[model samples]
Target: MRTTRSYLALALAFVLVLTGQSMALARTAPGPDGQIVLCTGTGPVAVLVDDQGQPIGPSHICPDCALSLFQALAETAPEIAAPTSWLRAHPIEFTLVFHSPAPRPAVARGPPQAA
Candidate 1:
């Protein structure tokens, strides 16, 4: 398991380096009508364009982007403990008893064995 974790960490680091290099090499240019262009999985796509076919200034994050960020955060967020009040209201009780093991019965000895 430790070896597997080390290999996984190395692989993740390599992937991140490659991704960073690729992103650094690639550049996104504006569309013909000065529309905001963003690189998508398929290709560069025009986004945040106005009715006048011009790029709109970034004022606020789009709902879809906000939702995606929220989901990412939720996935990475650490687990939270249950409320203290609730735990106090509903307490758990248990009894742990340890008993000695039973003694084994001894078998009767057989008659003297032949020489």
Candidate 2:
């Protein structure tokens, strides 16, 4: 009986948490021309933006996209972006090396004597 109640409580809590998150994401701010800004993007590859179209923190975008965004934002000096074409040109190569200590000579022993 206790187990059943505990499981029910856990499930209810899970549902409540999901509902709260969805509600938070569904929040929209009034946009220009009386339009409401809606959360956009599919799956985890999402970006939450403010009414001004500026991105908000704690977005759901992918890790790679977040990395690129941060790298672009941190650029202080004027420099060309790193080329990624070389990655496809060169194939990944893995090398494995094994090393073992010199083997010791086996010594012949007679039957064990009673201690």
Candidate 3:
């Protein structure tokens, strides 16, 4: 099962590579359970959602770029008590943004909407 998930992740990475978005060396940030693995890419933050496609919390942003992760967490710390499980992670925006010179890929897979 781990291998399968790795393959899936690899394939997604490959697809990103095929596009013009320039990605740096891979880095992943899985949730406390390790099942919800977020990563660095060219786009907006990944939204945490429930099974019905409703957002349970703010999107998870990449740590290397933009603002401090600690600050982002502090702003949203009150939402840690949400119930139920997520159906799947969705990346959004598809912007090639990063702190360094490398062009990042899509940050998350969900549609673009206000937080």
TM-score of each: 0.27, 0.26, 0.18
Q: Global CA lDDT of candidate 2, please?
A: 0.63
Give the per-residue lDDT of model 3 (tens digit) for 1-115. Answer: 9999999999998887764242232134333221233565875556565555555554344535545655667845545667688788787867776766678786868867887
Q: lDDT of each prediction vs. the true structure? A: 0.67, 0.63, 0.57
Ranking the candidates on TM-score from highest down gives 1, 2, 3
lDDT of 2 at 106: 100
Off by over 4 Å in 2: 29-115
Query: In candidate 1, what are the lDDT values of residues 1-115, reduced to their tens digit?
Result: 9999999999999999986665543334232344667899999986667668666654343433555776676747657898666434777999999999999899898888894
Ranking of all candidate structures by their lDDT, best first: 1, 2, 3
Candidate 3 global lDDT: 0.57
Q: Best candidate, TM-score-wise? A: 1
Evaluated at residue 94, the lDDT of candidate 3 is 78
